[model samples]
Structures are given as structure tokens and as C-alpha cells.
Target: MSSLVFDRALYRRRLGRALAAGYPDFLLARCAGDLEERLSAVLRRFGLAADLGSALPLAAPALRGKAEAVLRLAENPDAGGGSAADLIGDLEALPFAAASLDLAASLLSLHAVNDLPGALVQIRRSLRPDGLFIGCLLAGQSLTELRQVLLSAEVEATGGASPRVAPFADLRDLGSLLQRAGFALPVVDSESVTVRYGDLFALLRDLRAMGWANALLERSRKPLRRSVLLRAAELYAERFSDPDGRLRATFEIVWLSGWAPHESQQKPLRPGSAKARLADALGVPEIGTGEKPGGEKTGGEGER
Candidate 1:
């Protein structure tokens, strides 16, 4: 097995800082609340309840109410005691029993999980037949411009590449994993969001506050030099800043939704359908039995 890439302890610390800095409150007031409203509208279009808040009164109740029961596996226990309940555990190994849940939802959490596939499989195992699973994760394409600028600056200053940033899943690979984990009707899509920053340091600060810090599998042994940091900032501004001089951080958010198999699901094509011979269809020769062209073996008697 590959080594875990995400440090949960570090992630929790960063998340705590973000929460303390009122990031969550801002998200709820500015964006998450609107998103929840939009989700509720969509659900209502499908004849589901619009009063999702009453059912699951979390920050984003629409997303929460979609799940029969929600569990958030964090390294630390949740302090908020409102609508959405939380659990302190590991995603790779959920505490629920098999077929115990109807739906599972995760938001901006799986990107930091090391065993992403394992966690998906674990979640699948906890779901009942025809259960739904939905989540959003960061993709590898995120922050491409920033990475390029940082790399160029690092080489100019330190005569080598700097340490790697965090690893994010590609959308295609994530879809394949859903199928590999026995999910049916998997769908994966991505959207990009651009955040403007005054400077590179501000961008890094936002990332840190969002609990998205570097957790490279192989880190540099030596400490970063002051020159490298200075050069990196300058390069970042020159390369990544817009005409207005605002730095931009791009994030590609991949959404995945899939369903657990059920007895009522339609069956896929069978292997035998591809093996049927044209001659057999034309009534010229036996098919799939190794018979001769004229219906008799020219070489020897049948082994049977």
C-alpha cells in the first residue's frame, strides 16, 4: 500500500484556525447558504422537500438532508452541536455496519484523505442497496499557474525545484475508482473557481486558513531559504497577477455522485454476446464450440 499523503492532525489544526478566524461563518453567510438554497430548489424540482433545514438544520441543510444519516469523520471532535451530527473517526475505516446507511455525502474533505479509494469503498459498504453517495474534491489541475510560477522562481533562486504541493485527484481517476469500488451509475464533473489575492503571501494565507497546506510524501530535509521565498513572491506576482495586480488562485472542484447496486437495477450486456460467430448467425457453422467450418473436425475425433 502507498503511504498516506494527508496529515489529519495538521489538517485539523488548520481547520481549527480557519474556524477561529470566522471562515466557516463567512462561508455560511456568503456562499454556502446560497448553495444550500439552490440545492433545495433542485431537490424540490425532483419532488423532494424544500424545508430541508427543518430536517437537517446544518450550515448547508440541503446537502445534509440528502443523507439518511450524516457522519463527519474528523480528527477532532466537532464543537458545533446543531443540525448536522459529527463523528470523530477515519474515512478509510468508518464505524458503521454494512448496509446501515441510505446515503453518504462529503464536501471538500476527501482531497486531504490519503486512502481515497479505500474511503470510498468503506462508505459504499456502509450504504444500503440503491444508496446514494455524493462528494466534492479538489482536482490536480488546481493552482496550475501558481505552481508554474513557484517552480520557475525556486529554480532561479535555489538552483533546484522546491518541495511539492499537495496531491489532488484527477476527475477521470476518481470516476474510475467509484466504479472499481462497486458503485453503479457513477457521474463525475468539475468546475473551476478563481479567488483573487492581493499577493502571493495572501494566497498562501487563505490556503492555510482553508486547511489546505502542503503534505508532501517526500519533503525536503533542508529548511527554505529567505532568498527563495522572496524570489518566489516576486515571480508569483509577475506571472500570476492579473492586469489589476491581483493574484489569482484557481481551484478545480470535482463533483462525484454514484449509486449502490440494487436488485432492481438493469443488467449490463453479457460476454457471450460478443463471442457469437457471424457463421452461426448465417447458419453456416457451429459457434463457440470449436467446431470445423463444415461442422466436422478435419484433423481428429472430438475429445469428448
Candidate 2:
């Protein structure tokens, strides 16, 4: 697997801060906490505490029979003694046996991964039959207004197009990816959250703290000009500000759920149960007949 184009260390630090902010009503917030708190929540939600520690090799039991496990492929030299399995490696190339895990999860991750499909495939491979995988990703519609302003301002100030932000998969495309990755009974949905900021800079700050910076393949060599930035800020405020005079930043959260294949759930469709042909139901003449509804035999030239 290729290394992510974005700065991974910087991203992790930003994500840590964002998670620590504890934004209410956000799905990511629910899973952000110390290992014990996070594990307890997961256990309570799934209602599977018994034998959870044993079932998960790298897990530790916490309050209410909750457990936490951190599996990494490579060992971190800096990491101290802990139960957390330091399997530090790429998610796209997991070092685990096939069908070993019951559940897999990623929180505010995978967006920066270069090979998203490959990473998903690896996750699927690690799960047992009927296993579950849940994750969140930043989609195409997120930060739409900011992107437009940046592009327009860059072109106007620089007299050329600078590197644009990375392309994100739309909802439709994400759904197709789930199916293509061999997840059965796949379901995909999205939620657009509007975060209001006093100004454009505040929004950018939050975005940076959330580990979401422009990771264009071809980044600009020169520093951004103050004039260009000011113009961009003005454009952003004028175009995307709400009635309250606060700039609105949209973050589209995509929720994906799917189950692995199971024989007990498989069933063939009933024969001859499908809908009738459209031509037959509408009483329309068949194309090869070359005749009108009035029963006139049109010539070959007329048919053309």
C-alpha cells in the first residue's frame, strides 16, 4: 500500500485535539475518550460483554464487562508496556488471519488513506462471516463553499490554477464501493452538519484541528498572499454566511453499514414473480413488427 499523501503525524495530532473538544451531537464524539470509556460504550451498545476479552486477543476488560483492543501490525518502539496490541502498520495491508475478527471500526479515519478500497477489502478479510464493520468518512459535499472560494481566489490572484483539494467519493459512489468490496446487505446514508463560525479563519482553524487540510497532489510552491486570503475570506462570508452573519461550514458525514455473507440468510427469488413487460402492459406495438397501432403495415423506409 502507498503512503497517504497527507502528513500522518500532523493529522493524528489534529484529530486528537478535535476529539478532545468533545463536540456534542456528533457521532465521532461518542467514540472519543480514554480506552476504558470508549470500550464501555461499545460493549453496552453491542450487548456482548461475555467472553469479549478472550474473543479479542488484544483487548482489556473495563467496567461493566467492557473491553478495548488496539491491533497494529508493527510494533512502536516508543510505546511502553501495555495491553494495546501494537500492530503498527498500514490498514490496507493488515497482518491478521482471515475471518479472525467479529467487528472492525474506524473513527474519523480512512479519508486520508490513499488506497481506500484496498483498506476496506483488508477490513472485510479480517472479519468472520456475518461480522460487522462501521466507519465514518468525509465526503465530496463537505467544505463545498470553502473549496469554491479558494479556487476562485487562487485563480484571480495567481493568474493560474493552483492545486485543488483531493476529490472525495459522493454518496452514490460510496454505496457502490461498499457493494464492490463484497459487503452484503450494504446500506449507505449521509448527514450534512452546518458548523457556524464568526469568520472564515475560525472555520479553517477548526478544520485544521480536525486533521482536514488541503492535501493536493501538486501543492503551491509560493506562500499564500495576504491579499488573496483576504479576498477569499470576503467571498466566503458573502456567499456562505447565514442570516445570523456567521459563516456556515458544511460537513457531510456518511454512515455505512453492512454484514458479511451467511448461508442461512441466502434465499433465491421466486420464479415468474417479476413485473410484466412494459410494452405488453402499455399495449404498445413491438419494435420488430414495423406496424402502427392502427394495424397499417408501414414500409421499411417509413420505419426508418
Candidate 3:
């Protein structure tokens, strides 16, 4: 079986179409706002930073005074900007020499990557020593209400369901992925944003405009039955409607930051090398290595 999750080519085409039509930038704007705040907190400036495959042209504006140059990279010529990207490339294979970039920032990208682990490793490798990487992706129950209603409606109508939504990574898993990718000082955190819409169709329209429609490899080729769609809308209204009759949709944005390993960065102390015991710090009784929590030694049960 193919391990693929997203149809990258199809997604690029859809993204292009959305961009040409002017994708609603509310979400992208929100991400960019957060990015600005995070970037502002950092003390140093960057020589060159790449916006790797963000759906919108944001990095240059966000890094106006921080970075000397911003390289906008995308899968196609007209992606991530008006006329063309500074560099065209795919996340599966980044086009950068090892330890080349001073910083790498991607906004609202990376969720659709098939080989996320490999891509992360490549990002880490492309960064110069102590280079910073900061990005955000959709994760942890994003669009869960839409997912549930659609699946339930389909199963009810056709007696079988299809993959209509992409699976999101858990926060813990992404944190571990940074460590696995050899990123130092890794930080992973999530935020939830809820948007209200008049109805399911309104939400769907927004999603379509955002190029977030179903592009799953296992997605059903046939269009969703009108009956199923209507039923789903009904279910959504019934289950997720607010007091004012608007439907609610949740978007979970996960922000991740890490640095390329360097000698100046902080390191964890080895086990048994702590200068002070945790118990001492906490003013609690210390337990010996072989003793039980209750201060009982091994073989006590046998004696009893």
C-alpha cells in the first residue's frame, strides 16, 4: 500500500487556482500576525531566510527589517507571490546546500508533506550552525466537526465512508520529530482558533477558497452525493450550531521552532550527573535507587 497522504500535484494545481482567484487570506493573515510577534521576540537579525512553500507571500513583509534578504520558494513559478517565486522547489527535495541558510520560516505549510520526517531533517541540514527555523502547520483536530459530520453523513447514505479529511499530527509526535531531526532547543506548541459561519456551505466555500478541500490520496473520485452533503449540512447545523444559529469550525494551529545544533546552545545533563537531587529541590524525602516509593526494599513481600 502506498504511504502517501496528500496528492501533491493535485494540491499544487488547486493551490494555483485558489491563488489566481485570490484565496481568502484571513487564515494566512492570522498566521502572519503570529509569525511577526514570534519573530519580533528573537534578538538577532538574519542574513538570508527562505519562506518555504507558504500559501501566501508573507515572509518578506514579516521580516522587513529583520532579514537582509528573503527567498520565497514554492512548488511553482507563480506560487507564494504575484508573478513568481524566488525559487521553485518541492519540500520533498529542498534545493539548498548544507548549512547555507541563516533562517527558514514557513507559514501554514508542512501539513501536506508526505515525508515530513525527511523534510524536517533536510530543513535542519540546510540551516547554518545555530540557524533558526520557525513554522506553523494545521494539526490536532483541525476541522474535526466537518470531518465527523461528513463521515457520518457518508456512512449513513452509502453504507461506507471515504477519507475526506487529512490526518493531523499530534503535538507530542511533532515535538519528538524535531528531536529526531536533530534540532536543538526545539519548541512545539498549539493554539486553537474558532471561526463562525452562517452555515456548512459557507464554511465549505471558505475551505475551497483556501485550497483546503479534500486532496487525500484515498479520497473518493466520485463527487459526494448531494443527499449526503445536504445531510451533512443538516447534521452540522444540528450538532455544531451556536446560539445565534451560526455554525462553528475549529482550526488548530501548531507552531514549531528549533535551531540547528551548535556548541553555544544549552545541553541536557546526563543521568546521575545532577548537582542537586530533585527531592532536595522539592524539599521531599529522597528514595534510594532500589527502594520502593514507600521506603520498602526489594524482597519485602517475600519476607511478609
lDDT of 3 by residue, 80-192 (tens): 44646888889889999999898999888799889999999999999999999999999998999999999999999989999998999999999999999999999999999
Worst 10 residues of 2 by lDDT: 48-57
Give the top-scoring candidate (lDDT).
3
Residue-level lDDT of model 2, residues 1-304, one tens digit each, is: 4345655455445444443453222334432332234344443333221111111122223322332333433222221223343454555457667887666655545666667778777777777787766666778688888889988998898887675466677899888888888888787777787878899888776666444666544567577788888988999988998898999888787766665677765655688676776579889755547666677777767442
How does model 2 fare in lDDT? 0.60
Clashes of each: 0, 6, 0
Better of 1 and 2 by lDDT: 1
Q: lDDT for model 1, on a 0 to 1 scale?
A: 0.64
Q: Per-residue lDDT for 1-304 in model 1, tens only? A: 5586766666666665655554433222333454454445434222111111111223335555453334444444432324333555656667778887765666566777778888888878877787766666668688886677767777887678845577678888998999999998888888787878888888777676665666565656576677777787888887778999998788887877777899886778787777777777897644445555666545555465
Better of 2 and 3 by lDDT: 3
**lDDT-based ranking:** 3, 1, 2
lDDT values of the candidates? 0.64, 0.60, 0.90
lDDT of 1 at 63: 52
- TM-score (all chains, Cα) for each model: 0.74, 0.69, 0.92
User: Residue 57 deviation, candidate 3, in Å?
Assistant: 1.0
The predicted structure with the larger TM-score, 2 or 3, is 3
